[model samples]
Target: MADRRSAGSRSIAIVGPYLSGKTTLLESLLSVTGATTRKGSIKEHNTIGDASAEARDRQMTVEVNSATVEYEGLRWNFLDCPGSIELAQETYNALIGVDAVVVVCEPVVDRVLNLSPLFNFLDEWEIPHLIFLNKMDRADVDFMQVLHALAAVSSRPLIPHQYPIGHGHKLKGFIDLVTEDAFQYHSGACADPIPFPEELQVEEKSARQEMLETLADFDDKLLEELLEDIPPPQDEILQDLKMELGADLIVPVFFGVAEEDYGVRPLMEALLREAPDPSATAERRGLNDADNQPIAQVLKTYYTPQGGKLSLVRVWQGQIEDGMTLNDVRVGGMYRLMGQQHQSVLRAGAGELVALARMDQVKTGDVLTAHAPAPDLPVARMIPQVYAKAIEADNRKDEVKLTSVLGKLLEEDPGLRWEQQGDTHEIVLWGQGDIHLQVALSRLQRKYNLPMTTHQPKIPYRESIRRTTSVHGRYKHQTGGHGQFGDVFLDIQPRERGAGFQFTQKIVGGVVPKQYIPGVEAGVRDYLARGPMGFPVVDIAVTLTNGSYHSVDSSEQAFKQAARIAMQEGMPRCKPVLLEPILNIKIAVPNDFTSKILRLVSGRRGQILGYDAKAAWSGWDEVVAQLPQAEMHDLIVELRSLTLGVGSFEWTYDHLQEVPERFTTQVLQAAWNTK
Candidate 1:
């Protein structure tokens, strides 16, 4: 057994695809390490990770769960991150701060493809990670097949640290490649050492040779020893595994059934021996020489009903004491979380993940330091939103509270965004997919007690003229005392696209008074906001050719009415056209899905600009296209369905173009009906 007590403290993330038993593995780890007297089960809703009431109710993790455990006199902080792609922001943010990651997965070859996105992230950051092939008892496929399939998506070589002695639910033991020891698993206890099985000698020898060969790539001495038929010592093999794993040169593989607590102890021993120390990770991040002042970076922000606001942060250097000031704001409290519960601590040292209370000014990915200026840290960027909905308060009186509640939600999740559209006058909430927005909406009702109704967001459309026309307007009224009279002649013409609304006066004589001219322009601009197409009008020039006004009765109001009258009559005959918003989009996916994506875009009236390999992304292609905003509401749902959730896209407003004639009637009807 390796002595981790001398290794100091370390933080590791438990991450993988959804339903891969990551939480179960966390529980098994706690139990086997003696950190917990009893292991908790997800089915019982009593796991230490996924501790929030919302998580328990949904039986799914919605945010990052932090917990601390003491094993073999060494302290470990386990950040059990949500596995849902919709909630991956939590995982990405926390992964940057951890020393190493344990990627949990099932033993299904087909399901291994789901790990591509996460594997890409780990490779991009060059983070040291190990794979735990979880649920061994339930797997029915060949173990080597799973390894081969996983290697297709991973850039790093997969080095098997252990091989199973049996197959499927009958799995009984494992052969440790480095120690050359065979062990039989006993439920709820440590595995027992057994003699090497004679029936599996050939397989075990081959696997051990492969593991050694993979490690020998970085160790010329080991390679020379192997070529000379000289068996390396056990200590030397372990040292190579540690060095190669710490440098992220190879991904060591382990197999277990987390639900049964089998193979958990071996996994822990491997981590203690192979996982990198905090200093190694700091050097990898280029922060090895950072000043000794207390500096911390926030990994996730949480708003609990009991604690108010908690900023989950990782201390990169120095020590952070309670009541210390960071970002010029005082820390209200410091705590170590155990699931939903927290224990107050006086101070935390470097490489620890603790929650700082009432640091409301700090946000996710923000770096806070005491006395000294904060450092510029590289954090994960938020994924682009692919689904949106127009939201409104169910109770009209809660309208004022909606903004504040949504602000807090946004603070907790940078991926969740709310914007008040000026043109549509709708409060739009955007997220990764429909389920993501739905979860946010449910939180609004459950956490804040603010019920909201949501519908597909309306596309921002504009109206432009296809022809030109001239019309006259006259406002005359005979009342009790002073009579009101104003007249104007205006010419409306179509300008080039994107020209916007332009107003000028060509009055040769003093027909329209200069004082009234301002009012006429205001009315014309206001009327253009809602033209004959029942949408904002743009790219049209209106000229005040001639007009008349009365000195006493013709005020700004009268001239404004005259301009409104001219627009009401002339715009109807100008041949108005509806224009819908177009978005410039880049859809990234495996090259195999390029044709499928191209068809999806074309079917949505999207025009494909071109395609090329996505930079820095292997085996991936970027399909550039222009898609209508209206067609994008459910695009993510379908895109994920087609590409096994590995596909994603980023989009921006490109331009507005004429709505096709086939869809014009439907869009016009909806616009008029909404008004």
Candidate 2:
């Protein structure tokens, strides 16, 4: 908890594919760092990083989590992000405040390909990072072979910082390429600093040469020294390594069987010595008001037992004092976070990540600078791909709670969304995928004790006439002194596809009075909003050719009746047809699965728009197609099932295509019965 302990401290996010021991690695790091007295197991459902019931049930990380550890006199804030692509955006958000990222990868060739998205993101953001080859104890395959596989998938140079000394369950230890020291595993637990093994001297020298050459890539002085058979100073090499790391030119690679805790100490040393600190990142990210104004960005927000809405904010400028009103915006509360338990700090300075609690309208990605109405910060945004129709609380007792829960979820994850689906009166929650929305639901249940049920959204379909017909309708009723009476004549014709609904008038003489005529058109328009087939009427033009109405009895109501009667009589003769929504889908899959993916697309009655291999990924292909949205409601499930969870797709409504004749009739019958 000392200030100096976290002086050079850097936040590092552990990201990789699913079931790659991410939770176990987090627990191990906690145990080794002395944050926890005993390391917890994922199967036992006691890991610090996975505290939610859904996570325990799944036995895998379902959301992003943050934890801090102090070791070797420096604090480390490690963010263990979920591995599955379903929660990748959460991981990317975690990457925002952190100075560097540690891409935890499995020591297998095939599984390593799954890190493409993460790798691509790191490159896009130009974030300094490293390769952490985990599960070395169980890694029966060759380490260099795995590196070769990584080289094919990774765009950055994966300079080896360490190499395993052995293999399989007998993976005794690793040889540090930088220090030329050998470390042995005691029992997949906390490691002890030890002397190098004499037998590994040959490998140590060779690996050290590779490390030296990697460092010399950006240092001409070192390159000249190496070429002239002269040795460069160790301190100079360290400086260059740190410099290049900050510039995003080098990604230090670290090898460790996290379960064994074999290489953690050295990994920590590298992080402290090489990874950029808050000061360096502050200079790069730039302070908006570096001179006179206070500026900070709220990167994360969480609830605390007594702290009350702790916002984990990174100070980009002036100090965040305990009791200061930047612009009378908020009477700032305590600055504290859960360090094992809630710990308070009076103030946090520039480049420091701290928690600000009970601040009004202070949210994730908000620019908390000096102002009453804060200038909104540009934050990360992701498109939602999955959707589900929901209903208000069945008990009608949780409406407020559900609203609060939804607000919290949207704040935490920028990818989630909720809306009142106008067509079906269903409250729908849309997001990245099923797992993403499910995790949110679990978070709602655990955080707010709210229960919710989600069903597939009702597909928005349209019905249009294929043929034209004219019909007249009349309505008359006598109740009192005044009697209601109205008549309307409609000439309906098909328009070009996607022309939607149009209304016009062709009456030269007022067969129907002017006021009554507008009412008739209004009634016709209302009917078109929801057609007889229980869908919106589209691509049809309607005209009021002739009509009759009683001056006293004619009203919007009477004209509405006439229009309704006309539609009932005219629609059946107009060749009604059911139109299904078409979706433009872009599916990414491994090249080996291309044939299967194409077959599935074809089976869905899809039209191939384009197909090409991904330039960023090896052995991967992208298939662009347009298919019926109805067929794509569960397409993600099927794609994952077919491709072993290695495929992903983004799709949205493109256009409507006519349903098959038999299906159209069935749809019409279903709508008739349901209505």
| Candidate maximizing TM-score | 1
Minimal lDDT window, size 10, model 2 = 331-340
| Model 2 spans with C-alpha error above 4 angstroms | 1-8, 70-73, 188-206, 231-233, 288-293, 304-308, 326-328, 371-378, 387-392, 589-595, 613-621, 642-646, 665-675
Off by over 4 Å in 1: 1-3, 289-291
Each candidate: what lDDT?
0.88, 0.74
**Candidate 1 global Cα RMSD:** 1.5
**TM-score for each candidate, following the candidate numbering:** 0.98, 0.91
Q: Give the true-structure RMSD of model 2.
A: 3.1
lDDT (Cα, 0-100) at 478 in candidate 1: 78
TM-score of 1: 0.98
